[model samples]
Target: MPARPDRQSLPYRDCVGIAVFNQQGDVFIGRRKAEGDPEQSAELGAPWQMPQGGIDKGEDPLKAALRELHEETSISAVSLLAEAPEWIYYDLPDDALGIALKGKYRGQRQRWFAFAFTGKDDDIDVLNPGGGKHPAEFDAWRWEKLGRLPSLIVPFKRDAYDKVVEAFADIPRRFNLG
Candidate 1:
């Protein structure tokens, strides 16, 4: 199999995105499936979230952001209605994440991008990870109201997701999309 452009490098710190809405006002959320969080998935008995992942050495943050979004959520960058300019970051707790990444930057610097879902939830393909090693990034998916999402995500990721959600609030608000 060929490697995706996002996988051209290794161990880069870049995973982030803005969860956006579909035409009907539902927010897109990709459940990280069972692979990303064994403990969380087993514990909560639920799995889903916004698509996100690390960046390649030379990839632009937006490129990386869009890449992750598709690889995880199956939503292409072309589907995005708005993408953020500046990058936002968050550190992983000592108890979470790989050891190599834990001690260094503490967290990754991420650029968040927003999309307008052009297709329905059935369009998302969590099992088809494209160039990804794991076939599951999301087990189930759906679009919720943007206002309620910050609370729906896992606690550890909530803060980071919340920051981007808050920072990008103007997208739907300004456009009055939802």
Candidate 2:
């Protein structure tokens, strides 16, 4: 057989993910609004995911996480609980190999944050993110048991979600928020 292509040669995009946990320890998840994505295949399942987005140029990861949270869900009322010590990476599936992330990355290297939701549910306004520089990503959202995160995201991203769950698992007990 010929040599396989080296996926590691490609760079991973720097990104931030937020795990917003309610007082009861449930984390926030959002349903992806299906759109025409030339990068992804139709076979993928598990449209639900936590709030996440790219880290802009020279922007701090925590700042990016907050911005992503607000832009995607209009949620700004949160108290920083913890941050993952290591950045985790996830690779795009075969169908998304070349087109995902604008073909600039093999996958994403994400720094995740754990935040305690400090506001009421009414504070979340997914439909209209104020000012509208970025379009809405989730059509619906809900609080879910944190353990279910790995099974609720796209397959290619499951490992990262698992790591996120593991990294932030102690927050509830450590902070006695639950």
Query: Pick by TM-score: which candidate is best?
Result: 2
Question: What are the clash counts of all predictions, listed in order?
Answer: 4, 0
The segments of candidate 1 whose C-alpha lies over 4 angstroms from its true place after superposition are 1-12, 35-47, 97-105, 131-134
Among all windows of 10 consecutive residues in model 1, the one with the lowest summed lDDT is: 1-10
- Model 2 ranges off by over 4 Å: 1-6, 38-41, 131-133
The sequence of per-residue lDDT tens digits that candidate 1 reaches over residues 1-178 is 3322222232336666656577665677766545555335455534556677777878876677667777776665346566666677665544443432533344566777777766656666767765454466677777776667768766655677677767667776665676
Whole-model lDDT, model 1: 0.63
Q: For candidate 2, lDDT tens digit of each residue in 117-137?
A: 999999887777644656877
- Clashing residue pairs, backbone N/CA/C < 3 A, model 2: none
Candidate models: Cα lDDT each: 0.63, 0.85
